[model samples]
Target: MARPTKFQPSYCDQVIEHMTEGASLTSFAAEIGVARSTINEWMEAHPDFAHSVRIAKAKCAAWWEKRGRELAVAGGGNPALVMFGLKNMGADDWHETQRVEQKTTLEAVDPLSALLTQIAEGGRRITDRA
Candidate 1:
């Protein structure tokens, strides 16, 4: 048998209110006396909860961005730390440059050698054409 759920419809509003202050979903879960995974499960089971969570996420990012902007304009606090926080908290809006690398390998094989090697090595190539 499964345990009873602690989810309530009002939690949707609570999540948005909590995240509006730049709080994380994890923190919200902690405040509500639930694990983070429970939040994910609730979102999956309840569409309204999922929508509320989405809005809450955006609000959280906006809150972080607001702080970052305030610090940038005031020039009173550690700009680097604020930038780091924004990059981490508002990753969708603030992100560092990223580099991606792709590699391709080309191999040449003679058809006859490949066929003969395949026969000799039980359907496997023995050497590459050079």
Candidate 2:
């Protein structure tokens, strides 16, 4: 027998409120006395929970972005640390990117033709030696 799930409809609002305050999903799980994997399971089992999680993620990113903007305007916080946090915590909204282009050509060769060429070269070498 499995243990009863701790999922509740109120958890949807709780997660949104938690993450909107710049708290991580893992921290929310810890706050609710659940494992991170349990949170994932809840999302899979509950559609409302999944939607709330999505909203929570966006709100979390917005919170980080707001903090970054404040630091940039006030010139009081460690800019590098704020940038690192934004890049990591709000990666979808803040991060550096690079673009690369590559070109290549692939030619198909007949295995039998290659083998025959090698044999012909060996025959020429033998004739030259003789």
Candidate 3:
């Protein structure tokens, strides 16, 4: 018969919360009054624990990325509008929708306006003082 381990439910919950909050295994172990090696063993023994954290982190990142995309679209990517969305950011914020209206090659503007616009747009929000 297999021996029952002393892995308590509270301990497991603590581990999961710590990991989801971006703590390292060693840090988590320390936070919960356990040895780093012991926590590592638990992670190895309970593959689900590690998998859950990986999925959670990926989901969080995807959500943030998607939010940026939505904001970009909602602002119509106008420099003023985007800036408004970015500035005074509480539930909403920005700058003068800094993006070019769209991807189009027009002789009225520079031939490579579209390309340069694309490159410039890529520079948006690179420095997040917000």
Best by lDDT: 1
Per-model TM-score on C-alpha atoms: 0.73, 0.76, 0.33
State, as a TM-score between 0 and 1, how close model 2 is to the true structure: 0.76
List all candidate RMSDs to the true structure: 6.1, 4.3, 20.4
For 38-109, candidate 2 gives per-residue lDDT tens digits of 999999999999999999988888888888889978879778877876787689879899999999898989
Give Cα-based local distance difference scores for all models.
Answer: 0.89, 0.88, 0.54
| Each candidate's clash count | 0, 0, 20
Error of 1 at 63 (Å): 0.6
Candidates sorted by TM-score, best first: 2, 1, 3
Where model 2 places Cα greater than 4 Å from the true spot, the runs are 99-116, 120-130
Residue 66 displacement in candidate 1 (angstroms)? 0.7
Candidate that scores best on TM-score: 2
Q: Which ten residues in a row have the lowest lDDT in candidate 1?
A: 121-130
Lowest lDDT 10-mer window, candidate 3? 86-95
Which ten-residue region of model 2 has the weakest summed lDDT? 121-130
